[model samples]
Target: MNATAQPLVRFRGVGKSYDGVTPVVEGLDLDIQEGEFLSLLGPSGSGKTTCLMMLAGFESPSKGEIWLGDTLLNTTPPHKRNIGMVFQNYALFPHMSVAENVAYPLTVRRVDRAAKAEAVKRALDMVRMNEFADRLPKSLSGGQQQRIALARALVFNPRLVLMDEPLGALDKRLREHMQIELKDLHRTLGLTFVYVTHDQSEALTMSDRVAVFDNGRIQQIDRVDSLYETPSNGVVANFVGDNNVFVGRLISVQDGRAEVGLPDGERIFGQMVGAARVGDTVRACVRPERMTLCTRSGFDGGTPSLNTMHARTAGTLYFGDHVRVRFAVNQQEGGFVKVPLDDESLTEWSAGDELMLKFDERHLRIFA
Candidate 1:
């Protein structure tokens, strides 16, 4: 968001191609700031990994150029880049203990014994692994091993750190715990982090900004809250979170709003931008949590409401902290409403009941 300062890493029209047939990444332009945590999120074959590999010097750009601070990095080798990397498998040396593993990078650069030991100890303590410094990786838990790997990556105090699905191997609970720990570490170290992952929740939980990639291109990049609430297109809407999609056609445009007719016998109005006209096909995306369930007592026929949909409850799922109500929206089309368990009215609602779904106009996103 700071436009005046130069970025720590900049990619200007960067691209990659394997056989010179299809570019793995086409025309990528990004600026990653210092001391920020960013995530590249997408499904498999989306080119997120390809971009990370290019940045790490494992691969070269077929076209365009990459900049790290003041130096252009397209021709730089991996050893000269001074960037640390962490892989999904932890990548620890089996024969080495924790301290030794953390010391490998410093030893490779020919640092003296005293400096290497001090750096290793500081890195291990940063990740809370200094107590287990002498233990082999095989003797530690998955989370502990990951900590050792992180210490190894940070022991050299590199300016940038690239992580490829680094938390994928751990269990869910440990993964969540590490997410907080990693964010705190990044703050304390004040280093730039480029993380790659397919998990939307993980990205939303940890990233300062996220780049959503699809089909070998960057679809959208923004703060996590903006990306979830106002997705630029349908692909980003469905991929970033659980959305109830309503396919519609633009019927009219007035006062910066477009009227859309949904297939579920609902006519709605939503905000739109860029090259949309009457009779053009479009889509409306609404998040489940943004919907309000209206019972018969509170139901009103006429109001300033823009959209309404009818549904019959098919089932209810209790998630301990929240409740998920599944219903048939229109014929074969389905919908779900997620509500917190603290809502008192939901206690009276049961399966097979009729309900009206209402949503705020500000939360409705239209894509054409």
Candidate 2:
């Protein structure tokens, strides 16, 4: 990390409310590094968009303050924030060609004619849309239109850029392709990006850090890998990925492990990741890929160090590259285990087969 990577944006105890009641964002405290790509990710009405709107100066905070470097932006107007913005709908002018759309912001700021043309050309080339510069937005594909929108946002060379579900309108494949392009662009531009999205995969794929929000509050903020491996709570764990949960009560704790007793008399040991105490009600999370179908006795210590339970194979669903194995355990609601299609463990496995559901203990996460 360089010394120049100081925080470019800070939200200190920031909050927002519509009618002086029921705040949309409550007590938000975050520091965005100078060029880091940070994302506000959550479901609809989770305050993710509200946070971005506040930062963009489109909405006011009911309490606390927002800081850009050393300047307080509470009274600053949208254009005065000097931040670029991209909306979900692209928001390009219908009659404007790609070049004109890209140059709009610069024109509004009274940029010189020669400089505006040069900047617009550079921005279009950056987005790989220079060839379509003469085409109107309606004449371009969805992805092309989105590229124009992105170009417009960058043409001004703003220090910070805010994107609100910018790829939401594109198809799934195009969205994924754009995610790679945007991530590469972020690295090359070295501009601070404040991305807001409800898609967990989108956030995980593009963000250097992700802040998970729910109920108008930030539940957890961490790197993508860390957030998936050790979630702060059940809500975050369940929200981020495909997770299998087990409801149980902690019976004992020792050596950083918790012995949890499930609905049945079966007791399984799990690594305590979240807040869990003996005799406390808790939920355990395990990723599907970490689980395996155990039928042969040849496996003794191959599994991860965390939670294991006895389960019977109930059914299976084939998904081309992988298969989902559904099973039942101790008369309790059970979950699925996803494995590669060519795994040898599935050779003899069939529906109704009795087997031990194997999962790494280290991957087991307990949340209270």
Please provide, for model 2 over 234-310, each residue's C-alpha lDDT reduced to its tens digit, 9 standing for 90 to 100: 88999998898888899988876887889887777777865666899888788898877687464465534535577
Give the worst 10-residue stretch by lDDT in candidate 1.
301-310
Candidate 1 TM-score, C-alpha based: 0.96
lDDT tens digits by residue: candidate 1, 238-354: 899998777778988877677888665578877774567888888777899988787756778645654677777778789888998877776336778898888886776788888
TM-score of each: 0.96, 0.95
Q: Candidate 1 — which residues are off by over 4 angstroms?
A: 1-3, 301-306
Candidate 2 least-lDDT 10 residues: 298-307
TM-score of 2: 0.95
Model 2, residue 347: displacement in angstroms? 3.9
Error of 2 at 26 (Å): 0.2
User: Can you tell me which runs of candidate 2 are displaced by over 4 Å?
Assistant: 1-5, 296-306
